[model samples]
Target chain A: MPKTKAVDLVVVGAGPAGMAAAVAAAEAGVEKIILLERQAELGGILPQCIHNGFGLRYFKEELTGPEYAHRFVQELKKHPGLKVKTETMVVTITPDRKVVTTSATEGLVCYQAGAVILAMGCRERPRGAINIPGTRPAGIYTAGSLQYLMNIEGFLPGRSAVILGSGDIGLIMARRLTLEGVRVKAVLELMPYSNGLNRNIVQCLEDFQIPLYLSHTVTEIFGEKRVEKVRVAPVDKDFKPIAEKGFDLSCDTLVLSVGLIPENELSLQIGVELDPATGGPVVDSFYQTTVEGIFACGNVALVHDLVDDVSTESALAGRAAAAYLKGEIKTKRWLPVKAGRNIRSIVPQRIVVGQTTPLYIRARYPERNATLHVGDGQTKQQVVSPGETIYYTLKPEDIRTADGWVEVSLEGGRVHD
Target chain B: MTELTCIVCPVGCRLKVEQGKEGLKIIGNGCRRGVAYARDEMTAPKRMLTAVVQVAGSERMLPVKTETAIPKAKIYAAMEEIKAITVSPPVMIGQVIKENLAESGVPLVATGTIAGEGCFKPLEKSLGSE
Candidate 1:
């Protein structure tokens, strides 16, 4: 490490979370802040996502991924207190808010901040992560990586494709490949219903007449140099593959959009306690992690389908960091948050005393006419799906009036409040 | 009564469209957009087509889309035209690449930019072929 740069806050990963956090921290009167991004560009994955349907919540208009990311970058630039370092990968972090980064230009740089925010975001589940018995093939890719190759690098993956997992990314790729004149046979999902938004299911699959095989999983991949075909089998209610119900589909490529895992290597290195359900740090209402002075938000906290939510959550982290620097943040007492009913997980696993916190939640499964009970209040949900993030706000006064902990559960419910 | 889900938003409002004496009555919409979506869906369905077009100078493909929504009936034909067409850079955003696509009278325009010769590998020299 050369010169140790000291700042009020240090944010890792320059995606929506990091960018928004840096901007919020600066705007909240933090004079010095540093945002470190591993990519050569500051916008993160947004550059490669050329499709629309982003920024509906934050910007009030539909914009492409690059356009949505640019909004925060433009906002971050207005703050003179913030410095963005692209292509700088943060290799390690100490429990006491020290970040070590490296880039081609700057051989090794260190940042020692009053508060550190982990906005490392999440990564797509690759082929190796899942068990698909087959010969190693070259045409396999995660749906996100394929989007980058086709959209950013400007090249096609293959001629005909068989995509596994009917997640939003897979559905989007199905439409994208079809638009590029590639043949997509079917999109397979292990669940009964799609793990994507209904709009995506309609526009991406129904629009193109692509079949979606529910309760199905890819059993095997048969290829050597390049993909030739794949075997898909219908799974039971418990997700056990029925070999007798297996069928072979001939295709040249396979794209998997199974799931995402939060990028939390540095968070773990910093010794921040992680929430097993969300695969991210256990945070408080202020986005403060178990290790004081360190915070987390964005997909690093929970996988959000919309980038707009990531921006909103990360901004809270930024403000909290600034408040910590000013000694305005409370750390004496805490209220534990638990998921209840049909809910899967809740971010901000705990709440700081007398603070307003927005709870980001995910459902256990699909349900209609759903109501989320948080504390004493109930939020009526028109519909709920495991694919989307459901949020309920727990006011400070509500927390002050109630027990030491808050509980959030759905109709059939898992509890996190 | 016909049940349909509105694709206007992530909410995916489940709408009940019924034929009454006054024409069509829509229920279960969360917003006014749902009403409009239901109306259009029952009569003339339309969709915005976004796709990538091959570029001559750059190995990068040009992202293009219909300037406005096109009737659903013409989607296949529009796709056929889009598939057959190819253009060279430097293409500017909103520049019309093709006009009156599939008799829909909607222009297919560039949604993204593609830089010209100096930086790109010649189109023929590019790897990954059909």
Candidate 2:
């Protein structure tokens, strides 16, 4: 056993969130910051995502996933205070902010940090989780895993395939496979509307002429040694498969892009309160979790639809953690923040009303042409065209009027002003 | 007058389309993207496709995707042509899978890397043959 080293800040997961957080913390004058990643390399899921739609909102230019990640990696590299450990997995994070990790070089190591940030990102739902009954073969893979195998590992998953779920990853993969000289039978979505972006549905499926079967699902999978075929059928509003409407497609692969769940096992073990809605920890406006001195950001806090948001949020978390270490941020009491109609969840579940900071809330459902109003029952502030996520800044006066809790609600429709 | 649904946004606006003196006139679109979408749908619809390619001597398939949208009517033909092709390993990102596929003038491109040394697996038989 080697002697453990102590750092001012310990960041778990070296993806966009971890990398951004480390850089931000180091820039904020944090003398010692360590970034730990489980994979052999950094960049997380971005390396596998070779699409060019990223960085549009942040950088004002479209860049590939790898390119977007490269920008942050380069920034982290320039920060002398930052240390990154690849192929190191953090097994457990204690409530006291003690991080225990295992690595090939350092068998077992422990670190007690003044503040910790969890940026482990999210994981895709697998076939078993979705309850797709069929023979277990090597053909089925999550969209991200398939992307990695094809883009990073230089191996394709199959020649002909039926992709279940219209998630962005799956949609991107659908186009990726088609361009690779493979037959993409169709992209099936159980929802009446696509879960992915409208641009993806058009550019990926429509442009490719890949059939999109909405309100349909894979009823069963048939294969002896490898994927032979998949039985797809229409589903009712309640999502029950209509067996009579089933049709079998002859393909060798089934790619599942169902949904993503935030990776929060470490937070749970560290005694941080979890939000059932977001499946991540409940944080304050500063991104500090319920347990003081422990911060969380990125996909670990909530499943963001875009990687750009992950980097932006992680930078904030890193700044907050560094501030906390310097005793710059202190709050005695915080008020609970509640999600209103049509909102799936809100980050910074708690907020110190007097704190001069803005709160960010990301909605689970996409509301078209809607206005969001946030405040106590009597006084409210409104923002128009509130998309998936909206950030609101509360001044000292706005906080003074708070009766205890803040309510965020959606109002207006397409025609409503 | 014909009412067509625009799938550009969740709003799903029903656009009024009719032949006027100027040409196809479209109304009730939400954004610029919606207007372009209506124009394309009324004239010619295009789509992008992605699939895996069999890399010679590799167990792993190389992920490839289309760089541009092809004509809506030509998608099946493009897929047929893409399905008939295979590439060797050491394929780099943005590599051309098939140039000017099916004469649609859209290039099929590789989205990721493929290792040089691996066995190529057969396509899953579960998805019915075209």
TM-score per model over all chains:
0.91, 0.78
lDDT of 2 at A40: 64
lDDT of each: 0.83, 0.76
lDDT per residue for candidate 1 within B1-130, as digits (tens), equals 9888777766677899999999889999988988988898999988777777778756666767787779988887898998788897777666899999999999998766554765242221121111
Q: Is the docking of candidate 2 incorrect, acceptable, medium or high quality?
A: incorrect
| Per-residue lDDT of A311 in model 2 | 81
Q: Which candidate gets the maximum DockQ versus the true structure?
A: 1
Write candidate 1's Cα lDDT for A1-417 as tens digits: 467878888889888899889888988999888888777556777767777777877877766775576577668768777777776788889987778889887888888889888988999988878878999988999999999898867678989999999988899899989877789999999988888888889888998899999999999999989999999999998999999989999999999999999999888888889899999999888888899899898989898888888888888889888988999886657888777777788887897776778888888887877788877767888678888788788877666345778888777432221
| DockQ, all models | 0.23, 0.10
Q: What TM-score results for chain B when candidate 1 is compared with the true chain B?
A: 0.84
Candidate 2: DockQ? 0.10
Backbone steric clashes in candidate 2, count: 51
The lDDT of model 2 is 0.76
Best by lDDT: 1
